[model samples]
Target: MKILQITPFFFPSIGGIENYVYNLSTNLSNKEHKITILTVNTENVQKEEIISEKVSVYRCSLNFRYHKGLISIEFIKRILSANDYDIYHVHIPFPLGLEIAVVASKIHKIPLVVTHHGEYTKGNVFFSLISSIYSKICRNISLKYVDWILFLTSSYSVSLRLNKKIRKKIKIIKTGVDIQRFSATNDGAILRKKYGFTANDKIVLFVGSLSIYNRYKGVDYLIRALHEIRSVNNSVKLLIVGEGKLVSELKELAKELKLEKEVIFATSVSDEELPYCYAMCDVFALPSISGPESFGIVLLEAMASGKPVIASGLPGVNDVVKDGITGYLVEPKNVKQLSQRILKIIKDVKLGKKFGRNSQRVIIEEYQWANIVEEFEELYNNAMCKNGDGGT
Candidate 1:
């Protein structure tokens, strides 16, 4: 099968969607399927990251959106003539590339699959009316052109409420991670020694964009939760990984709470270094405060690292974190619940290990990249068959 993924973001830009697409292509490449990707070219980066013999990357600019005006006529022409890919799998949020895929499906006579990341929720009072209209158009057009709708979480049902038509095409598929990398790195001793994280010091990890606008990834909730966590365990320290607009503000907020030392920030980290951070942590928390955090990829990463997770009970995140077993789930933005859950994991090492092992079990049994790639391959084949394209 020849599969192509289109997204507005990719490597060097960290987030759930970027991780999903990278894992998808890598896993698919390992499956011996011909897989390729087209993403926004940052600094015009072009380097083939060979996941296997079967995968290749083609990077190009929709540079206008990052700097200039609207989508250019050239952008459409560029993608149409890009390459010969059997099926087009597009990850969405950006209305620009999505609109092109809608047209490309018709123009190229290829099967198109659009995965819904989740719908936008907040808007200013004056723009709310325009936002609503834009959302409806996006849903209607996306559903109409897409041969299949890939859902990261069953909770996508809420986003589907506005467009019941897309439900018929929906397939529940989880975003996957490299379980071996995480499980193998959890010796916990070296990382502990390296980071100066003491035995009694409870380690908490928060990874994602720290942007004020993108704070929906929920560093704030994690900060608020710390007030209670520190009360129970003074040695508790948070290691926040990622850089964004909200860094300064979040740092200020931590200082205001007299937690400047308690909450330590890591600007940006390489993937190789992530294992130690994950291995050393007592708990992995993603308090993402957004409607569109379709899935907490890091929860799986934490589980892979043999650590329990504490995450918002949002549909996408809930899909990854099995409440009471794999990790505890708290209501979104509830600082008290978030704090209580953290304390539970910190105080009870048995419970933490139990949940961490359970999380690992879930990853090995269901969320491994190998298993996820198989599902995606089947979806691609079915799409090609429907389009009368050459597919086995």
Candidate 2:
């Protein structure tokens, strides 16, 4: 099968959607399907690059940004002219590319599978209204053309509250994690020694971008929560991993809260070292304060690392973190609650280990990449058959 994935960004971008598409495409290619990724060009990356014999990528130069839409007329033209695709799988939240994908699928007579990674829930009231309208327009038109619509979680579909006609096309397919790579065996001693973390200190980890645009991640809240946690448990230390525009601001906030000693910002680390960071931590935290976080993939990674998770009780996040079982879910932006949950996991060694064991078991049984690939294969076959596009 020849598959084309339409997305806004691809490899080297380090975003949730970018990582999702890359992993899915590579896994599909490994399954003997020829895959092509159609994405926007970024700095220091080739316009066209071959990842493997079965996988190739084509990038379109981004022209400009227009009110949440990227204007890439040339890219749209190229998409219309591109040929020989058994299926068109588009990862949405890219308004401009989505419009082109709808037209391309129609003209090419290809089976279209649209995956809604989640809606873009950012900005003030005016911008939110505009985003809502844009998302609705794109979603409705794509649904009209698409044969299947994939969602990461059932809660996400319920949140959308689609009409009967559009709801019929919905399919829930969760994203996967590489279980072997993020195992509990990864040595944390190297990082612990390098960072000078003592056995007396309880490590709390938060891994994600720190950009101002991503301030909804609630790193500030985590910092503040750490401050509150320190008043009682001074041994609690924070290891925040990732780099973004808000790095300085978050540092300033930590300093302002007199938490400079408690919080350690590693800024960035290699993929190989990420697992070690998670394995060393007493607990993992994702305090996302927005709806944009459809499914917290980091929760799976942390779970895969055999570490207990403490995350926001948002719709999508709640779907992943099974409260009191896998880990506890605190109300979003409630610094007091977030602090308490973190303390519950880190302070209780026995309970943390139980959650860690449950985490590993869940990933092995449900969230492995291999299992997710098989699901995609089945979905693709079902879509092709339903659209009368199955077979050679």
Candidate 3:
């Protein structure tokens, strides 16, 4: 099968959707499927590169940015000209990409599978309203033409208010994690010592971008919760493991809360070292406050590292973390509850270990990338069969 994956961003650009496409493409390539990734040149890296024998990536020149989305005329042209693809698998929240994919699918008579990651949300009301209107128009049109719609969770599908007709084309396909790279055996002691954290210090980890567009991630709420937790537990330290425009603001907030010593900002963490960052933490938290955070991929990474996790009780996120079993789910933006949950895991070593064990079990049983790729392969084959192209 020759598959073309269209996404807004790819490798060297860190985010859930980028990671998902990278993993899925590579895994499919490994199975002898010719995989080509079509993405924007966000990092200004090579325009075209070969990742593996069967995998290739072509990046389009980025024209401009509109809120969270990238606009690229070259991308649309490439999609229009693209030929001989067995499947057009596009990851969305990328309105322009979806629109073009819909056109290309019709022009070429190809099967278009859209993975709706989430909706676009702006920080301000006026832009939010405009974005909502634009999204609805694109979504309705894409739904009519696309062969299938892949959602991260059933709850996320519900959040979109997809009608029965649209729901018939929907398939629930959760994101996956690399269990081998993020394993319990990975030593966290080296990372803790490098960061000047004492063995007795309780580390609370938060991993995600801090860009203005991702304000809904609620990193500020997590920082405030850390301050509340530090009021009583001095040994607790917050380790943030991502860089973005809001880094300085978050640092300033830490200083204002007198948590300069208690908060560790690891903005330069590489992909190779991410597992250690998770392993070093006593608990992982994702306190997203809105619908844009459809699913928490970092939570799965933490679970794969055998760490206890805490996330917002958002639709998609709540479905990922089993409350009180794998980890606790606190209400979005609830600082007190978030702090309490973190404190619970930090204070009770046995309970934390139990949760960590359960987390590892869940990842092994459900979220492995290898297994997830097989499901994708099956979906693609079925799509091919429906088109009378026969399964590869």
Best candidate, lDDT? 3
Clashing pairs in 2: none
**lDDT, each prediction:** 0.77, 0.85, 0.89
Model 3 lDDT tens row, 1-392: 99999999898888889888988888888788999999999999999999989989999999998677688999989999987899999998787888999889888878889898888767578767878887767677678778789998988788886667778899998778888899999999999999999989999999998877788899889999999998889899999998999898899999999988888899999878989999899999999999999998899999999999999999889889999999999998899999999999999999999999999999998887788888999999888787777878
TM-score of 1: 0.92
- Writing each residue's lDDT as its tens digit, candidate 2 over 1-392 gives 89999988787777789889988998888889999998887544779999999999998887886434566766888889866888889988887687788788778787888898877756678877877887777567667768888999888778875678888888888888988889998889889987889978899999987755577788899999999999889999999998988889989999999888789999769888988999899999999998788887889999999999999988778889889988999888899999988888777899999999998998888887788888888888887787676644
Tell me model 1's lDDT, rounded to 2 decimals. Answer: 0.77
Off by over 4 Å in 3: none
Q: RMSD of each candidate?
A: 2.5, 1.5, 1.1
Question: Which stretches in model 1 have alpha-carbon errors above 4 Å?
Answer: 42-53, 66-74, 120-131
**Which 10-residue span in candidate 3 carries the lowest summed lDDT?**
121-130
Q: Rank the candidates by lDDT, best first.
A: 3, 2, 1
Where is the poorest 10-residue window by lDDT in model 2?
A: 65-74
